[model samples]
Every structure is written in C-alpha cells, then in structure tokens.
Target chain A: MISFLQIDLPALLVGTLAALVCALIGNFLMLTRQSMLGDAMGHVVLPGIVIAFMIAASTATWVMLTGAFAAALFASLLVEFLRRSAGVEPSAALGAVFTAMFALGVLLLEQSGVARTSFDVHHILFGNIETAIWPAATGLSSLFDANALANLPPQVARLGFGLFIVALIVILLFKELRVVSFDPVFARTIGISPRLIGAIVVALAALAAVVSLSATGVILLVAMMVCPPATARMLTDDLKTQVLLSLAFALASGLLGYAIAVLLPLGLGYEISLGAAGTIAVVAGVFQLIAMIAGPKRGSPRNA
Target chain B: MTEFREILAVLLLQAGYNTTVVMLGAAALGAATGTVGVFAMLRRRALVADAVAHATLPGVALGFITAVALGFSGKSLPFLLAGSALTAVLSALCIQWIVTHTRLNEDTAIASVLATFFALGVVLLTVIQTLKTGGQAGLDVYLLGATAGMLRSEAITLAAFSFIAAAVVAAFFKELTLVSFDTEYARAHGFPVRVLDLLVLALVLAVIVIGLRVVGLVLIVALLIIPPAAARFWTNHASRMTIVSAIIGAASAYGGAALSAVRPDTPTGPVIVLLAFAILLVSVCFGSARGLVIRALGTQKLPRRVS
Candidate 1:
C-alpha cells in the first residue's frame, strides 16, 4: 500500500492553506452576507488570468496573481457602480457582470489559444491538486533552503505566502472587519470609512480566490468561502467561535476530500483521477448538511 | 443585388439542416427562458437558475451512464434531458429547503447548491470518461454547448418543451403575478403559495433542460436572467415585461445563432449570453422607463407604476 504521507503531504498543505485563506475572509463574508461576491470573483478571475498571460507573454505565478487581483478589483468596482449609480439589484448586477466576464474569458481563450500556454481550462474549472507535491528529499523545514524551495511547485509557495499575508491583514484589521461587517453605518459613525474597509476585504477575498483557485477551482472556492462559515454559524452564535469552527471545518474538508480522491482509485484499482477539488467541495457540503440538521441551534433566516 | 440575395439565401434555408434546427431550438429556448425569467426576477431568485444549471451536470453524466448500461445509446438526448430535469427539480427544492430552514440567505444557499452539484458532476464526468464506450465526446457540450452537433429531432423536442412551458406560464400568470408581488397577501387571499411557487420552479427547470442543448450549463442561467431583467428597464407591468422579455430573448437567440453559424470558431452559447448582456447594457442606458440617460437628462415621462 502507498504510504499516506508520501503521496499527499504537499497536496494537504496546499488544501489546508487554501481552506485557511478562504475561512479567514469567509467568516466576515458570512457575517456581512457578501459570500456570493467571492463566487462572482471566482468566475471573473479567468479573464484576468488570461489577460495577464497574454500581456506578460508568460505564465509566471506573479503575473497570473496580479492579473487576478486587477480583475477582482475591476469586477467589484463595476458591481459597486451598478448598485450605487444605477438602480440595478445587487444580485442581478453580480450575476450579469460575472457571467459576461466569464463568457468573455472563454471567448478570449478560444480566440487567442493563449490560455493553453499556462492555464488548463479543465484545471481552472475544477482544479488539479494532485500535481502539488514535494520533490524528492524535500522537507517542510527545508522549504527555506534555496535548492528545496526551488524544487517546490511555485503555486504551493505562493499559497503559503498568501496565507501569511491574509493572516496579517486579519490580525491587524480584526476590529475594523468586525465593525464593518456588523454595521457599516455604525462604523462610519465611529470614524471609520466602511467603503475603504469593505473594499479591502473584497480585495482580500479576490486575492484569496486567486491563491485558492489553483488548488480548489472556481466553484469549489465559492463553496469553501460560504459553506464552512455558514455551517459554523449554525453551531455557534459567538463570532470568534464561528471563525475558529469555520477554519477547522475548512481544514477537515480539504484533508478529507484529498483522502477520498486518493484512496478511491487505489482501492478500486481504477485508472482514473477523480477531481480533488470537487471532492473537497462535496465533503464541505456534507459538513454543512450535517450542521444544518444537527447543530447547536435550529437555523432561521431571521438570525441571518 | 443577385450576390446579396444568394448570400442571404445561403444564410437562411439553404444552410445546413443541422444549423437551421439548432437555430430554431435556440430561438425557442431563448423565448421560453425570457418569459419564465420575468417571474424569477420578480421573485428575486435571479441567481437560483445558476444553481439549477450547475446541478444538472451530474444528472447528465448519470443519465449517459444509465442509458449505456440499460442497452440504449448513451447519447440519447431525451434520456440526458430527463436526468437533468430530475436533478434540477430536486436541487431547486434543496435550495428552497435551505432558504426556508436555515439562517443562511438565499445567495448562500444557492452558492452551496451550485458548487456542491458541480462537484458531484465533476466526479461523475470522470467516471463517464473512463467508460468502455466512446459516447462521452459530445457530453461536454453540456458544459459549453455543442451547437454543431444539434439535430432536427432534438430541436423539435426542445421547441415542444418551450411551447409547453410557455403555455403553463400563461395558464398560471394571474396567480404567479399575485404571489410574486405580495406573497403574504397572496397567502392571505387563499392562493396556494407553496404550490404556485413549486410550479414556477418546475417551469424554470423545464426551460433549463432545453437550454442545456443551446447554451449548456455554465451560461444557461443568463438566458433566463438577462432578457427579463432588460425588459424590466422598459416596463414595470408584469405582463408587458414578459412580452418584452420574450421578444428580446428571441431576437438575441436568433441573431446570436446566425452570427455563430457564420463564425466557425465562436461557440453558440457564449455568443448568445454576450448578446443578451449587450441588450441589457443598452436597456440600462436608453430604455424608456428607467434608462440612465433619461434619468440623467430629466426629460422623460415618469415611469407608470402598475400598483
């Protein structure tokens, strides 16, 4: 039998970091009812990534990440404009803008064939976590060593750095995030600009999505951003507990999903790579379903 | 003049039979989605169709596998559509269940369902890809649409479904509008609110089934959402909104399909969505009732509110 750690340590770390990044922002998103924006950003990030590739004429990780950030900022700005300036409903605006952007991305991908250089449409839609692995003799402590770090898949290292940045932002802006999430008007009265904070949070979510998308794909990223926190909320009323519970659930889902994807093929002796990110999404759904049915409190729309 | 006539003729009836059938199917699918979409928009479930669309993927894969196992051609359109219809209805109910039972907002519920269903689909598609038969080639069309593979029989089936959906909506128009605008009042007035609500869900699901052929799953909801939303800019009257939405839907469907026919590389579904998006943008800027330009200039007549 294949050793568990041998095949999946790097994949697990990547998933764990993705879950952590998503859970950090996902908590506030659930609190503020802005979870769906993550979904929209996930959809529209494709065009940004493709555009970045085209302009850079390379598929460097930084180029893709920057492209995704700009795209998220642009999409969120468009949504804000449509809602604030025009009279369009918020959900409709998000649906319209993201779908249009996603379709445009697909068209561009077809026309330019540039996406094939660095992006796989299949991998982008569902993700390819199996490819995240440590090279021979690479160890966690050795990640800092130049030879080992160079051997690391750049996406994994980027996710690690992303998690540190997100953790720092959350730590530094915890109170601001709480106030803005709970009551923007109250935040404004207390001398805080809710718009700036909200923008930062959205930017953070978009950036997290860029980092996570490589491992979890777009739809699964949406699932992670909403389901874990939403499920945690079903089990607790305390904000801190909700955040912690969400992080725990996110990590559990990533690990469990990876286990299922790896074991099923080996057990059945099948020649197939069941999508890892999708399995993680399914596992997260299972967690939410269990929470909704048997959590500490009965869920009601009023609480939301 | 003769050359222009010849070109026009070639573009229309003289085109390949598959093109004509697919175009007709596209038009019907568009009109039906637009008509049903008005109700979805009125009820503020603009993104619920997205959930329904994604939820159908697993069903399509399962349907293919089941058909093959049962000694039928796995590519049977009817079987695949049935599978989609079944899953779509079930998942729509699940979303409703989450919304009515949980503290999560409808958006969260929708996002969860959409993602979860798509996840299940990805798993099933992998299985389908590993099948012994070679019938999985066109199945991915349900992802981005395989308009070139559309045939006369499938188009006929789709058109019939659209007509049936339209008739059902027409039959329940009064009750639907009543419930849409004022659910509590409709309940107070003895409307079977739950029944009517499920009926609308069923109608949306039916249109989505036909839509899978034209636009596939990824962008199918746009067909339901964009045209009706654009129509809302022009009129507040629900009936008039439905009519305008259907017209916009048909126009975009026919026009987009024609353009795709000419441009060999352009997929029919995305082109259709982009066209609808363009129309919505135009409606936002210049529509008579709430056009931004009219509002900016302050020269247009006040929007006539039905209430």
Candidate 2:
C-alpha cells in the first residue's frame, strides 16, 4: 500500500490530469471539426521541446513547456498560411506541416547527439510516466503536507494548471464557442469574430497538448484529445452534457487503465507491468467502441 | 573535401553495392508514394494516410511476436510488413466506418484511430521487451529507419513493392484522375467511385508498407504529402503534376539516402523527409504554376481595372 502511494498514485494523478485537460479542450475541437489540429499540435510539440533543449541546454520543465507551446503555435500558423496563401487543401497542409516538423525534430535529435544522453526518440514517444514516483510521500497525510506537495512530479502541476486554464476558457467563452462551433456565419453576424475565437481555441488546444505531453506522450495525448470527446459525442446531442460526460469518461479511463496496467500482470502472476499511457488509450478506445455500437445518439438522421 | 567526394560517389551509385541498392530502393518508394499522394490530396484524404501510417506500429510488433512464435526469425521483413499492411487497411476501414456510421467527422475518426492504434503498438512493444525475445532489438529500426544495416534482399523487396504500386497507379491513371477531380460526376457517369477511392487508399497502404523500411512509418506520410504538395506548385494538369511529384519524391529519397550513407550517424527516415521538405520550400518560392514568386509577379504585371 505504501509502495502504491509512492509510485502508482502520482502516475495515476498525472495521467488523469492530462486526460481531463485534453478531453476538456477536445470537446471544443470536436465541435469545431478541428480534431486534426490537436493531432498536429501533438506532433509539432516534439520540435518545440527539442529546440528548447538545444537552446537552454536544460531539461527544466518550464523551458521545454514554453518551447513546445511556441512550436505548436508556429505550426498552427504555418498550417493556416499554407491553406490561405499556398492554395493547399486544409488536410494536406496540416499533414505536410506537422510531419515535416516531426522529421526535423528527429533529425535534430540525431545530429545534436541528444539521443545519446538525457533523451531519445523512444522517451519522446512513450514518456516517463513510470518514473514519476513521489518518493517524498509517506502516506495519505503526505497529500496535505507542503513538502510533499512541493515535491510532486512536475507533470502533475503542469497538467493541473493546464486544466484550470482550459476550464476557465470554456467557462468564460461558452456562448461564443457554441455559436462559432454551430454557426460561424451566425457568430460573425452577431459581432463575434469567429476567427479570433478559433485562434483562442487553437491556442488553448496547444496549451493542453504541450502540458499533457510529458505524461501521456505523443500517441496517448492525441488519443485523449480525441477519444473521450468522441465517445461522449456518440452518446449525447447536448453540448453541456457532452462536455461533462467526456470529462467523466476521461477520468474513468485514466483510473481504470492505470489499475489494469498494474493489476493484470500481478493477477497473471507476472512481475512485468503494462504501459500506463497505452493502457489508458486502449481503455478510452474501448469506451469509444462501446459508445459507437450502443449509444442513444449513435445514428445519423438519415440512418435513423 | 573527402566528405564531399564520398557524398558525390554515393549519389552516383559508385559508393558500393549495398549503398546503391538502398538508395535505389528509397527512390522507388518515394516515387510510388508521391504518385499516389496526388490522388489522396485531391480526394482530401492526405491526413487519413497519416492515420494509416501510424496504425502500422501494432502490426509490426504483432508480426514480430508471431514470427518468433512460429519458429521463424523474428527479424523477417516480410512478416513484419505483412502485419503492418493488415493493420493499415484495418485503420483505414475504421476511419471510413466511423465517418459513415457515427456522428463523428472524418478528422476525429482519423485522429482517434491513429492514436489508439499507435498506443496499442507501443503497448505491444513493451510486451515484446518483457518477453526477452532475441533479435527484438531490430524492431526499433522500423520506428525511425536505419538503412545502414539493411540487407540486400530487403532492399530488393522494397524496390519490387514500390514498382508494383507505381505501375498500378499508371494503369489506373485516367480513372483515378476522373474520380479525384469530380467524384459526384464520376458516379453520375456510372463509374465505380467507391472502388476507385479504395484503390487509391490501397495504393497508399502499399507505399506505406514498403516505405516503412526506408522512411519509417512516422514520416512515411511526408513522402506521400511533401512531394505531391511541392508538385502542385509546378503544374495544374494532373498527369504533369503526377510526373513532377514522382521526380521530386525520387530525387529527395535518393539524395537523403545517399547523404545518410555518407554520414551514418544520421537516421535515414528524417533525412529523407527533411530533404523532401527542402524541395517543397524551394518549389513554394520559385515554381512556375502557383509559386509565390510567380503569383506575386503575375499580380504586379496585371493592369488595374479601369471601371
């Protein structure tokens, strides 16, 4: 139990926080039909962190996080530029920009010899969730202890801050977001600039992606940004209910996935543990699959 | 000076048999992907190819584990690629299914499937690590591509698959062009638009599977995207664009592979993509059809309306 408090608890907290933040922003992304932007942000964050590391020569959390946020913002702007100026199709522009950035990140990782120490491609992809142990925590009392709180994993704090920002944005701009998502033309007629709102939403998504990246890794970050909201979308037509359901689903996936990752191996009499992020993604996918098959709102009007 | 000479030698195929084979294979894969990419971009399924490319991870891992289970060397490229092909097709189908059956849009489906499949692949990889299978170390090469250790047979297989994919594109050129340009019109004319769409996706899958060894799955979509996107700046005619895209793709792959051969420390996949991106950047600036320079100059030369 003590081992669980030190090791499993922090990992679970970080993973759940990452999931909640991603799912929170993901609801708007799905409604706006810009889910792929979340995917693009996930890929571009790699170069941001890599360049940050190159410049600062430090693995400090803030340095890398700032770098990631900048890269994501730059990549989003590049995608917009390519679409508007280059006459490229939106999907193609996004695909081209993100992949090129990712490739650049990988090349830099190799050429700078960063892959030899401190970080590598595998670490960037799978993340270090298992190492996010809270050695300072002694038991439940440590939860309220200032020293223990101060020593919490950096990812937990980052993701918590990200969740706060996302929830704040969603709350403050709920009406504008709904109007733009459902009818951008209507939003523009009503004096709301859909473009500005779109940019803010994209910026918020970038924040969510950058903050969640170190805990969830690239694949799980994308999954969390997509699967929970999609699953909720399948089950409900109401925006408010969908957002609430998605958060619940995200929390559920994180907890259930971490539990399974640790328990399944022990139950099978194997000492090896599964990947927490991967398992969470899988559990989220399972929820999505179930929703797809059985949700009340699963059918389109024509199909119904 | 010596490094320059070595790079030149590799480019000219005078480096050695191994280097020549690998470079040629990469070139073939590039041409195939670039050719197919034009249709995918036209159909607005460029990012869908990304989802499919990412989905190959689990297939590769599953293929390795199965190969070891069957008493074959787990490093067999054929088994691994075959596994990737299965999952790639499955992922594409899942995207199609979600778009058709659910309220979720194609982008959401694509992102979700890409992430979920990739995460599953990562989990399988962890499983492989724990299993302590011999030769499992080689599987990491599929993630980023390490052509420095590619075998002769593997290069031949890659070249052959690439050629077959390209030939299929040539055979269906007109039908594909028709469908991509005007899908509803093609359907009105009783053409099999659905089948043609599937064929384009299949061609994409073929390129991805073969290119997995050269560019790796992570950036293989760039081979399908960057070259065609660059080609778009040079030509408006579909046929001309396809040819131009193929050339750019082949050139980037050949150049990137040769450079990697000269400087073995650099991974092959990213170098290839970076080279493709460089070509894209150049084409964006100077190409004749829609290049920014041409557009800017053309607008300047236009007389102001004297209404």
Candidate 3:
C-alpha cells in the first residue's frame, strides 16, 4: 500500500499543477469565447521557438519561452492586420497566418533538422507526462524534504511556479476578469479597461501554455485549456462556482487520466504505457460529453 | 550534358512519369477542395474541415494495422482512405451532436474534437512506429506527405474523384446557393435545407479524403479554406466565385507540384498551401471585383465584413 502511494502521489502532483494552471486561465476564455486564441498560440509557438533559437544562438529555456511569446504576439497582430486591411474573416485569417507560419517552421526545421534533434514534434504532441509525474518525486518522504523538492525535475518546478503566478493574478483581479468576460461595455463604464484586461488574460494563457506544453504536450494543451472550464460552464452559471468547479474538474481529470494511462497497459499484460497527454484529453472530452447529456445546467433545451 | 538533361527533364515534368501523374493528381485535388471549401466558408463553418482533417489520423493508423493483420499490403491507398473516410464522418457526426446537445459554441466544438481525435491519433501512430514492420516507413508520409511516391492508380483515383465531386456541385448549384444564402427561406421554398447541408459537409469530407494522400491531414484544412477565400476577393456571383476558386486551386496545385518536382525532397503540402496563399494576397490587393487597390483608386466602395 505504501509503495503504491509513493508511485502514484508524484504523478498526482504534476497532473494537478498542470491542470490547475490551464483551468484558471481557461475559465475566463470560455466566458469570453476566445478559444480560438488558444488554437492560434498553439500553432505559432513552434515558429517562435525556432526564430528564438536562431537569435539566441543557444537552446536556453528562457530564450525559447521568450521567443514563443513574441511569435504568438506577432502572429496575433498579423491575423488582425489581415482581417482589417485584407478583409478576411476571423477564422480564415487565423487559418492563413498560422498554417503558413507553421509550414514555414517545418521547412526551417527540415533545413536544420532541429525539429528532429531538439523539438521532437511527436514528444510535443503526446508528451511524456506519465513518467514525469512519477520520476519527479523519488519517494513520498522526499515530498516533505525541502532540498529534495528543490532538486525535482524542472517540469514539476516550472508547472508549480506557473500555477502560483496564475493563481495570484486570478485572486488579485478576479472581479475585473469576471466583468470583462461578461460585459466589456459594463467594465469600461466602471473605469476598467476591458481590452487591457483581455490582453493580460491572453498573456497569462501564453505563459500557461509555455509551462504546460512539455507536461501535457502541444495539442493536448488545447484540451487542458478548454475542457475543464467547458465542463464547469456546463455545470454552473455562476462565475465563482465555475472557477471553483473548474479547479475540481481539472484535479479529477488529471489524476484519473494519469492513473488510467499508467495502469491500462499493465492490465493488458504489456509494459508499454500510452501517452498521458492524449489520454487526459480523452478523459476530459468524455467528461464533457457526459455532462452535456446529464448536467442540470442549461446544456439541453426543454421541449416547449 | 547531364546538367542540361536534368534541367530539361524537370521543366517538361519528364522528371518521371510518376512525377507527371502526381502533379496532375494534385491539381485535381486542389480544384475540388477550393470549390467545395467556398460553401463551407460561406456557411461560416470554415474551421469544421480542420476538425475533420485531424480526425482522420486514427482511421489511417488503424486501417494500415488492420490491413497488415489481414495479410494485405497495409500501404494500400484505397483501404487506408476508406478507414479515414469512415472515421472523419464519425467525428463530423460527433461535432454535430455536440453543437445540438451542448451550449458550447461551434469553435469550442471543433477545437474539442480536433484536439481529442488528434491526440488519439498521436497515441496510435506512436504505437505503430515502434512495430518492426511497415510502421517505420509508410504513414509518416501522411504527416507532411511525400507526393513522389504516389502510384499511377492512386493519381487516377484522385482525378476521377475530383471530377465527380465538382460535377455534383455544378448540378446542384441552384439549390446549394439558395440554402447557403438563406436556410429558412430555402426551407419555406421546399428545398431540403438539411440534405443540402449534409451534401456540403460530404463534399468537404470528399475533398479532405482525396487531398490526404498528397497534402496530408494537418495542412488539408488549408487546401479546403485558402482557395475559396482567395476567390472571394475576385467576385460576388456564386458561379463566378466557384470558377475562380477552381482555377486558383488548380493553379496553386500545379505551381506547388512543379516546385516540389524541381526540388527533389521538399514536402508538397506546405508548398501548395503557401502558393494558394500567395494568390490570395494578389487577389486581395489587385483582383477586379473589390480589390483593395482598386477600391483605393476609386473604382468602388471598400468591402465591409461579409462582402
């Protein structure tokens, strides 16, 4: 029993932190209906990392993160410019800008073979989260050892720090985010800058994405950002309840999904585990699907 | 003497018979995607095709594995494509289910399914790649696509499929336009709005399937979206838009194939998409209908959002 606890506890920690950070920012995104922003960032982050590598001349972690954020900003502005000046629809504009940029990134990677050597597109998509959770904590006792905790894998530390920053922002300015999400006009009337607040939310989203990518992978980050909040939204109308419920759902999905990914292969008499990030997405999607059918919130229309 | 011959061969597409077949096949695929993609864009559901494209990944991996299990050449295009078509339709149905059954917005619905299905594909592909046979080589082509390897029979199949799809759209032009413009009005006029909607969806799926073996899934959405969007800059009439889109699609595919042929190892999907985008840029700036430059020079009023 003790051995099982030791094995599962660290995974539970890493999954919770990754899920928490994504969900906190995701709730506001759901209310604002800017989920496409998440999609846009996910694609653009690739080229950002590449260009950053070229300039930094080193594959330092901060350089890649900075490059990713800058690329995302540039891509977002380019999308807007295409829409405003070129008269493209919002979706089409995003599709045009990012696919071109993504393809460009691919070609650049091929030119240098950097994608194969460093980026590992497969690793970015499915992630190495299952073992990340386990290997970070060598044992349950180390959880209480300050020096041991300090020596944890960078993924665990980075995700934990990301959650801290996200939580601080949410708590410090909860009401402003709520108002901006619900009604920007009302927010502006009350001396708040909805646009500014929205920008901050997007910035937080990008930061969360940077931290979450290695743990949850790139495509799975979309699920992490959208699924729990979407489920919470389906379950409640109150913003506060949505936030709290989103946190709870994220915890459940992360732990449950991680556990399933780890144990399922063993059950099948094989040693190979499935990708944790994808399994988590599947679990979250399934939860949302079930909630759509059974939740008491207004997911379904009544027969009038 | 060798250098001159190499240049001449590439210029004439004497690069190989295989190259010629692939080039023409790509053009047909391009034309079909652009024409159908316009209606999808008109309905403002342009990104639904993205979901469909990503969703086909699992079907592809499964189809290959299942074929190998049954003692057939797992790399057979037809069987793999059949699997993809089934799964893409299933994912589409799931999207429809979510839209009707949940309060989630359409973008959210597309994003959810795209992410989920794609993740599943990643898991399956990862597993397949570890197998000692077949897995190490074939399906990676579906990721970025390698057009040179396309068989003559496959090229013929793609060309034939594109012609049939374009013909069906041409035949149903009137009904499709009416429903696309005003669904309730079309229904009141006794046109089957739902069936027309399904037809539009099926057309998009067909473009996705035919485009996959060459263009791959991730970039397949570009083929569906970019051509029609570019064509919209040149005209307001539906038939004219369709024509222009087809031409643009054909031209881009031709251009991309030629480029890929010249450069022996370049991936074809991105080249085609980028070419389509280049035409769009030209169209947006200078096409006659409501081109930005033309409007700026006082030929007509500038376009607003939906124009």
The candidates' DockQ values read: 0.59, 0.74, 0.52
Of the candidates numbered 1 and 2, which has the greater TM-score value?
Answer: 2
Those runs of model 2 whose alpha carbons end farther than 4 Å from true positions after fitting are A301-304, B304-307
- Candidate 2 residue lDDT tens string, B148-229: 8889889888999889999999999989999999888899999999899889888988888888888888888988888999
DockQ of 1: 0.59
lDDT of 3 by residue, A106-137 (tens): 66666666765565555665666655533434
Best lDDT goes to which candidate? 2
Candidate 1: residue B155 lDDT (0-100) = 83
The TM-scores, one per candidate, come to 0.91, 0.96, 0.89
- The parts of candidate 3 lying over 4 Å away from their true place are A1-16, A130-151, A298-304, B1-11, B131-133, B182-188, B261-265, B299-307
lDDT (0-100) at residue A45 of candidate 2? 90
Q: Which ten contiguous residues of candidate 2 chain B have the minimum total lDDT?
A: B298-307
| Model 3 agreement with the true structure over B1-307: per-residue lDDT tens digits | 7656664676477777878888888889888888888888877766788889989988998888888888888898877899899889999998888888788887777777887788778777766765656644778777766676678898899999998999999999999899887888999999988899989999999888888888878788887778887888899888999999999998888777777676656777777777888888889899788788877876344444338
List candidate 1 segments past 4 Å from native. A1-7, A133-145, A183-189, A298-304, B1-13, B182-189, B263-265, B300-307
Candidates sorted by TM-score, best first: 2, 1, 3
Tell me, by DockQ, which candidate is best: 2
Candidate 1, residues A91-190, lDDT tens digits: the string is: 7888888988888888888779775665666777777777776664344556457766576666777788778888889889988988887788999999
